[model samples]
Target: MIQHKTLIIGYGSPIRGDDAIGPLAADALAAGPLPAGVNVISRHILTAELVEDILGADRVIFLDATVDGEPGEVRVRSLAPDASAMSTMAHFLDPRELLAWSQTLYQHEPEAYLVSAAGAFFEYSNYTLTPAAAAALEPMIERVRELIATN
Candidate 1:
């Protein structure tokens, strides 16, 4: 069995400016030695495999970027399986739906959290994160670390 008390999965496309923050933060966390009982994975936000990946973990935190809000504004929220605020995209299953499916299919309902950094640029380009978004990474990681440590 895959055993872990907490899991951090950072998902985003690295090529899309601020969208890269999640993966970048994931890399920073991965480079350091994590506390016991914690695990982290950095990847694009795809559904099929991610649902299976989260099964049985006690707590799961998914970090990503969102364009619907102010840039660099970090929003953290506990998400339920049926939350209406979630976005639905055919190419990507909503995170809440994935959690619900995991509970129904695998009998696991981990405490789910989403950490989203407001995104600015989504267009094609060789771009870097804006200064504000870059500044938020450390605090976000620190918060995740604290959550993992306490839970």
Candidate 2:
């Protein structure tokens, strides 16, 4: 079986302007030679498959864009493995809900966390992230690295 110590799931769409933040940051991290046991994947959407990807990982960090919060502000929340608390965003399977279901089905739940960057524009065909969002990327990446390293 493949094993990953840290898995970073970056979910977003580049065509939707600031929604691209997650993938962009993921790309930056991927361009580098990451620490041992680290893996990164970029996705245009978040799905139930993410639960499988996160399984057995020492730490799982989900990076995504959110618009219901302040622009450029980053929110780090430790989600409980409970379906009800999961935000039913645009995802087919809410992440927290998937985690809950996976725990019941597989008998294991990896340490999961979400780091969201607030987005300003999610317009169609706008392939550039907002200045504020772009500025937040480096810090976010560093924060994630630190979190994974310490845990």
Candidate 3:
């Protein structure tokens, strides 16, 4: 039997309020025990170079903060490659775009998911999360754990 490889990427701006949740949660996960063949990474933002990282994984999970739902709410959604999801800016790449890169370049797109936490504040801060966003941290981590188990 072959071991499954899983990659977990948590990315966001560390100085931006609430937005830091992604990388922070990733740090927390890395500090604990994980299943074999699982690896965790924390990034300030997603970049095109990550396409190389995805090529070897069987599954990838992204953690980030979103303003789409109630503060402290956590959402998990599956992801697929989409070339049209391109970003005009050069600094960051959307998770889906990275997946698209893997699919186009290597013809191997790993099963992917985005686990996002709703944030109430996005103002510049000293590496801190708003109260509501902080409250969602555990739930966000728990959701990732569930995905790890079921996937």
Which one is best on TM-score?
Answer: 3
Give the distance in Å from residue 56's predicted Cα in candidate 1 to where it truly belongs. Answer: 3.6
- Candidate numbers, best lDDT first, in rank order: 3, 2, 1
- The per-candidate count of clashes, in order, stands at 0, 0, 0
The TM-score of candidate 1 is: 0.86
lDDT of 3 by residue, 1-151 (tens): 6567989999999999999999999999999999888899999999988888898799999999999999999999999999999899967899998999999989998889999999988887667898999999999999888888874
Give each model's whole-structure lDDT: 0.78, 0.80, 0.92
Q: Cα lDDT of model 1 overall?
A: 0.78
lDDT (10s digit) by residue, model 2, range 57-136? 76778888889677888878876577675565745656677678678788668788888889899999998989989887
Worst 10 residues of 2 by lDDT: 85-94
lDDT of 1 by residue, 1-151 (tens): 5445787888888877888888888888889989777778898774657777787478888888888677778878887765343455656767787787777788788998888888777776746888878887887788777767663
Q: Higher lDDT: candidate 1 or 2? A: 2
In candidate 2, stretches whose alpha carbon ends up further than 4 angstroms from where it belongs are 1-4, 85-91
